[model samples]
Target chain A: MTTTAINTKQFMTSEQLLEHWQGHRNLTRRVIEAFPEKELFEFSVGGMRPFAKLAVELISIGGPALKGIVEKKMDAHDEESFNPKTKAELLNKWDEETEVINRYFGQISEERFQETFNLFGQYEFPVYQNILYFVDNEIHHRGQGYVYLRALGMEPPFFWERF
Target chain B: MTTTAINTKQFMTSEQLLEHWQGHRNLTRRVIEAFPEKELFEFSVGGMRPFAKLAVELISIGGPALKGIVEKKMDAHDEESFNPKTKAELLNKWDEETEVINRYFGQISEERFQETFNLFGQYEFPVYQNILYFVDNEIHHRGQGYVYLRALGMEPPFFWERF
Candidate 1:
């Protein structure tokens, strides 16, 4: 599949995208920090899944995808691989994955950003587009985290402070 | 304000970014289509702003930014400029801006992506980062739209269909 618009003109580098992704990740970590323990696991709006479940979905995707990309291994998403029983465990898992990403993202060389890789054996695209996907997806989910925090009467980390 | 991790390694082109952004915009428009009339404007979880408010903020930002980039003009964000009373009005406004973006995005030269501009007279960054910010912000809000739809017992359009 043609996964991106294919404008490989190079506006940003691998390291830059990595930092961009991590900055958003840092802000998201703050969002996780602000969540009330019970609300993180139990709060629901109009029957939507709790923020914890959604957070786990994000936590499950990133590190695994980056590992797959770096290792050239493919694994379809498996929810059973992680079943965090509490907010603390979930947060710990998220931080562990963040560490994994920081390590693995750097392993992919600059040229790799231009090569096409089948992401999770599903998306076949350049490494740059795949990296953009990771950043875009996190920002998207973080949007929800913002709402969940607001609903709980808490202020989320400032959106601009993604560092 | 250095707003991005600017390595200036150059990986994507202006046209490619525009296409990528349009793809995301297409999905978001479909998301807007999925909203129920009343819930689009009235629904809120906790004390979060309604999805309609979020949508307008997006609609307001993009077209003007593109116009600014294309014409070398700058306008600070003024929230009072829009206060849509209904979903139809909001959707119409969104379409108008999309058309504006479509027209102006093409006017940007390839080299323009490397030049720094103050997005909304606030963020001083390269044209590429500013464009990325537009896409990033939209995906973030679309995340909220997803939650609102799911909470209303509605399934959103699949997120990957950016065409």
Candidate 2:
């Protein structure tokens, strides 16, 4: 009898993907909560960017890019149209997008992960590359949040042990 | 009539700092919400480290370092206990630390931000440098989140336009 090779091409099960995504999001959320409202916007280190701008960037990118992935469409331009005047408003938007992401994730099929797509009309990469990009981006920004937290003399959330 | 010069240092009041911090936190929470739970602990990009490990490092450095800044005390061996088990538990701890940060920020005087402090018994940096680290670290992680979000076919939050 011949043994069949295991199919490594199978994408992550929806359950697995969702779990990892949520875990990362939760960690990022903790970092945000650790900050005081004042430092979130005006605080800076060594002429670097402020925490608020960085947060805006995260919002602008995460929502639309994910939407594009689900729809199988590539955005020709970067994200625009971010307008939150207060911390409350930002939180409200954050809550709204959380639901949006879940809905989008629900629609993904395993076969879709194997399909290749164009990101920002720049690179022709596999779906896996795009997925990796999502995780990488979040980690990058979270690192910035760590810096801000330290500057303010406040503890941030732990990085390891997210299940 | 002589015009009085406004102190640039005084402009960044504690209230403003708090708002900024809160806004940053809210945005980060959205990033966490972008992903599923399991990936939070297991996902990795290239040969790079997992986001979970990074979160642990953040937690370890963030709290004690902040305390050191506020108390004007520094210890070299503070980066040892940066481990956790589950994503939910990590998030819970993140929430707790947020409260501590708020309390610490509330006590900050404008004079204190300019005061210098030592970090990890190795680097002698100003309070501002330490504060900036928190925000910077967040950005770094969030960048990774962005990559993950892209891969997951979900959009990340905007980098700018945080209120």
Candidate 3:
């Protein structure tokens, strides 16, 4: 850690990262909800990944990574992440994972934000960037979700209204 | 400038933010380029904003917001943002604003990251948060772009490949 004269209190508050991340999570949950059952799992444009598969990827990352962060575990993340059978099961897992995120977010100390923890023992960045990857990956997949929804002749939830 | 013991030097670097943001911009620009010329401005789902309007809104936010951040000149942002009658015109405008973003991002300093600045003479926050709003808004709009692209039977660029 470079101890420069400048302080790092506001580089990113835990609250800010949490809220920013949760906001994306909330929007993604809505995106999942908007899809028809069959289309949610099957719809794709030009042979791209389906929304169900993408949502499963997000489910795999969020809750498990939070546990690893708090418990100092570097468990391998290459398992077949999530394979929920139905849309209802997917939503349940997403909710369960959201709770996991909230709980683990509470366990993080301000000092932990600065510590170097090897994420899954592969990506070696600070905790902040790791958390951001969660959001960035979600946004990328959710963009695919939007594509799927529009292809199915359905309107997605407004992008600006995330609570 | 809260100077504390644990240093937060690597929470985010200027280069990281630029690379991350520029990657998103490249993907969004490609999304714009993928649209059929007639549909780029006209298509919509259930009366929500069109992709073209959303693209206009992004154009308004990105370059103008960067100018505000680096130059400390908070220009009003409520006029007609971009009115390209042709897809070629819109692409030209996107390239122009991207250049503006590159020029302005160079002007920001590490110290400027810590300062609290009101974005567009409203939405006051730290400069980093403001910069993030630009990226967040773009992602949100670009999701719409993806939807539009799929509706047109076109494929958007892979989200993670740009870097």
Candidate 4:
């Protein structure tokens, strides 16, 4: 009898995925810190929103979305709810949200990751995909931040140096 | 005897991952198409590199990196080689690279993906993480493209509409 090797290997555990995501988060937080206080709030490229606004959008989504996912609450997307006027204020919120994400993300079981959930009452996708969306969206914004930093004649964190 | 369900289910197949990456690529291609020829090459916010240059970086990496992975070639990264002068020329190269990615990506066996690869003679990582890096990097640059498009008063393709 001839048989093929059915690949049963796990690609990544949930914990590994979390670590990978948090690595990106750490990089993004650095990006946020890299910006000049005034520029973070006031810089723009080709009429794009400043990095501060972009960072706020991320802050609004990640921890809240994970909390929503864990709690099974499909609250409407809220970009305007949290507004920080200063860099320190924003970073404080960011740290708080990081803790929130860690708490909620750990609560998701492997099976639940396969279940479909409507994120923020829109963007219906599997729980894992939703998490991926959060990560992907963050990376995209961080790329813009890199550009913004370069325009400001400052160096942003290296993309591959995520630990 | 009591036993717990050992979560052996797969999160995504290699095929599914390919499709996911391609979806982002399709969205990015649309962004490239949306840019005015001059603006694509010349536009900047805060002195960041132009979208054209960023697009070239993607082109330089994706297909070649995949080929390198499949062939086990540790060739150095090359971003300065292909110089497309027009939008049409760049798009053609993009299309060609897409095919190249498909071809090389398929050649990697399931076991091989778990192997470590020194991508571009730098950035040593497991093959799967290397692939993830490519996707993440693309999303990041495309994010910059979104800002550029908006600054020009043109609507970008929705980030979620990747198909």
Q: Largest DockQ belongs to which candidate?
A: 1
Model 3 docking tier (incorrect/acceptable/medium/high): acceptable
The CA lDDT of each predicted structure is: 0.78, 0.59, 0.76, 0.85
> Which stretches of candidate 4 lie above 4 Å from their native place?
A1-11, B1-11
Q: Who wins the lDDT comparison? A: 4
Off by over 4 Å in 2: A1-12, A161-163, B1-163
Rank all candidate structures by their DockQ, best first, as comma-separated numbers.
1, 4, 3, 2
Give me the runs in candidate 1 sitting further than 4 Å from their true place.
A1-8, A109-111, B1-9, B83-86, B109-111
Q: What lDDT, from 0 to 1, does candidate 4 have?
A: 0.85
Instruction: Give the interface RMSD values of the models in order.
Output: 3.2, 23.9, 5.6, 3.6
> What is candidate 2's lDDT per residue for A81-152, written digit by digit as tens?
776566666667766777777777555555565567786565465554465456546667676566567656
Relative to the unseen true structure, what is the C-alpha lDDT of residue A153 in candidate 1, on a scale of 0 to 100? 75
Candidate 4 per-residue C-alpha lDDT over B6-98 given as tens digits, one digit per residue, 9 for 90 to 100: 233345456657777888999989999999999999996766778999999999999999999988899999999999899999999999988
Off by over 4 Å in 3: A1-15, A30-53, A65-81, A85-91, A102-131, A143-163, B1-10, B44-50, B79-81, B109-116
Backbone steric clashes in candidate 1, count: 6
Best by TM-score: 4
For candidate 4, write residues A1-163 as lDDT tens digits: 1112323334545665777788998898899998989999999777788999999999999999998999999999899988899999998999898889888887887778879999899979988889888999899888888888977889889888776
TM-score of 3: 0.71
DockQ value of candidate 3: 0.23
Q: How big a share of the true inter-chain contacts is recovered in candidate 3?
A: 0.19
lDDT of 2 at B137: 60
Ranking by TM-score: 4, 1, 3, 2
**DockQ of candidates 1 onward, in order?**
0.50, 0.07, 0.23, 0.39
Q: Candidate 1 DockQ score? A: 0.50
